[model samples]
Target: MQNQSFLAMEDPLDALCHHFSLTKALLPPNARIPPTFDMTLSAPPSRQPTHLFAILPPEDNARVPTLMIPVSAGLYGQSFAADLLPAGTALPVPHIQNGNGAQPPCVTLPVVPVSAPHSLSIPLVLLFGLGLETDRNLLAQRMLPAQVIGEFPHFPAMVGVMAKLPEQQFEWYLGYTHGMWKNVLALAPKDAGLVEFVQMAHKVIVEAGRLRGRR
Candidate 1:
């Protein structure tokens, strides 16, 4: 059975292509094989979205650590900000409500010179929970300034720094992963490595941040 090369395959991309009978012709330079996942959303075909952008973890079969974002009209960037909305909040538990999600919290700090009685225009509450779950000092000093910077002067996803979030809260927080990617996609060139499995997985995080693969 050692000669049965199929089982010997370690690369998830190769396995995905082999199992799915995919053609690699005309593929980009990396020849990445999209991962296969089983999604059974009750949303009908017509209502189901057709565009998606994903960033996979480095390890093989890295679905568990993958990030998937929705793509609207083949555009996923700052220019497409209107398409990416904060469906809800994700702090203590997943409070996501699609169209009824919470806006960025309206901060009323003690005599702070920031905005007042006003939720942050950016959809950060849905993506990163108002940037106030933990790391009070760091977020106060860093995240808040970018978040309230006028609804998205650019995509404001700070994944590298948010690594300190709790596992479950962080996972649930993925509901807004799209907001993060769209911003990055807007600024990135089409061929600038943000396209495959994707070229910019390092540059963007997924909607759910659950890290699923595609095929």
Candidate 2:
């Protein structure tokens, strides 16, 4: 489709809705943009500079920032405990007894508490990772409470870039605002809509960063 055709369309949302052959009922209420958060796995400080915008309040100034841990093994164990393990055997060694009478490897996680409507409780992505077993297990039962709407089990490496923000938001920018304009400039269509999208992404990054700063 040409840019002119898109511009000619009366409503961008309507145009998109029509393109997707979607019904009005299928659309989100008020066409709202969803909240975002970073879920990259816990990594060293060097990986954090890129996602400064993604940090939330309370977490913003964390001298020792929270690490994103990919709980791939943990998630798998939780999701399919019975099928993978022998009868009466539990894959989560500490939690269950293996039918073979052997203890499977287990990792302890840390738990942290958050107050309601608190800064860090704001919805965003969260990733899990495996680290050396420590007396301080940071793994909480739920990464966040029910109120938050972020994705879980995200990959850790993406922390250097977008981390846990919506994948759509991830693609719209480059490393940071410095690369924001250049990234958009390389778009294939080079249309006004594309420009608008990139600008929105840039705004989100700035806004999210500012929000973190406030906390």
Candidate 3:
């Protein structure tokens, strides 16, 4: 319950794991840190700064980012024959690459709030935010194997930031974005464990997908 007890922890993350009273959350990837959101899917995704870390929930794994969760993801960027998509299908969810990451992307998820036994015992806390930014970048199914991203419907949408707070509703542009860290120290060291980080990232993805508009 005190920093004194956490001082003996060999790994800060382990201490984090201990603080959370978790078992499977150990050895998380990226030390439970999200990508710096610097450049887009392109460029190097350097590690950013943070004050919190969490384990990925069982709902997701490495290859599967979103577990078929549905959300009101605004309007469709493109139009496709209803038969091709047939609802509840895997989507190559487009990642919009525009401005440098400077603010948290605004988004929402449907999470059943739970009471944390160690909520008060844990010595640290972290808040997470996500953006619902997607590229109207279209890919037509009719094109088949030839045209990788044959144009579909194009909806011009900008990336916005939404953050998670204790007992609060998600609002857009309510958080900070990447390259925005000013005073916060890096939660994980340079050689932080990747296993736990990946696991933690899985949690973020799952949270973001909580309201996924489509598959």
Candidate 4:
């Protein structure tokens, strides 16, 4: 059934491939598999050193510990890190002083302004939440990537996808586990392929919910 779905939606599958390539090119050189952290479609964990690359809502700035690196709008009418930062540019790392006056542990993270030619040497948690709305722009302005919407329409969607694939494959191929698939579901236009994908994902989410209840 999964094979048939993949075969039937050849165009969307191809679009997925293209999206993956385009998104990967924007990742920092030192970007590695981020540590396991709890996340959801509406809310991300507040305390963890998680890296997010989504168009976040304004409130997220306070909820999540993130350093904003504003960039020029991309040709696709979206803002991306690669467009703003030059290749091989050194990103600024801020040091936080513990209130106890104790020397904080030296933490290494990937630098910002992730350019194409340069590679970040330090391991940083890179959260790829593209299309998340940080500004008060209209709904159309915050449309997320099709891949994100298709695979992770909601938190349950992550659970659904995870149930089907091994951890390694999911992490290596998709980068992040949690997503706002519901957001995408709301914004997506009426297209046969997209609707079919959403339906399949929705079923997976429902089944996952059922299994969770059983547990």
For model 2, the superposed segments whose C-alpha errors exceed 4 Å read: 1-178, 185-189
Best by TM-score: 4
TM-score of model 3 vs. true structure: 0.17
* Candidate 2 TM-score versus the reference: 0.20
Predicted candidate 2 versus true structure: per-residue lDDT over 18-111, tens digit per residue: 2222211121222322222222222222111111111122434434233212123333234322222233322222221122335332222221
lDDT of 3 by residue, 1-215 (tens): 11223324223333332322222122233233332212112222222211122223233333322111111212111211112122432233323344446843221122111122222211121211011111112111110111212211111111111112221222211121111121012222122222233233233323433434232
Supply candidate 3's per-residue lDDT for 148.
16
lDDT of 2: 0.27
Please give the lDDT score for candidate 4.
0.29
Point out the higher-scoring one by TM-score: 2 or 3. 2
Off by over 4 Å in 3: 1-4, 24-215
Candidate structures ordered by TM-score, highest first: 4, 1, 2, 3
User: Cα lDDT for residue 80, model 3?
Assistant: 13
Stretches of candidate 1 off by over 4 Å are: 1-36, 45-47, 58-64, 75-142, 145-215
Q: Kindly give the number of clashing pairs for every candidate.
A: 16, 18, 30, 11
Runs in model 4 deviating more than 4 A are 1-54, 58-179
> Against the hidden reference, what TM-scores do the models get?
0.22, 0.20, 0.17, 0.26
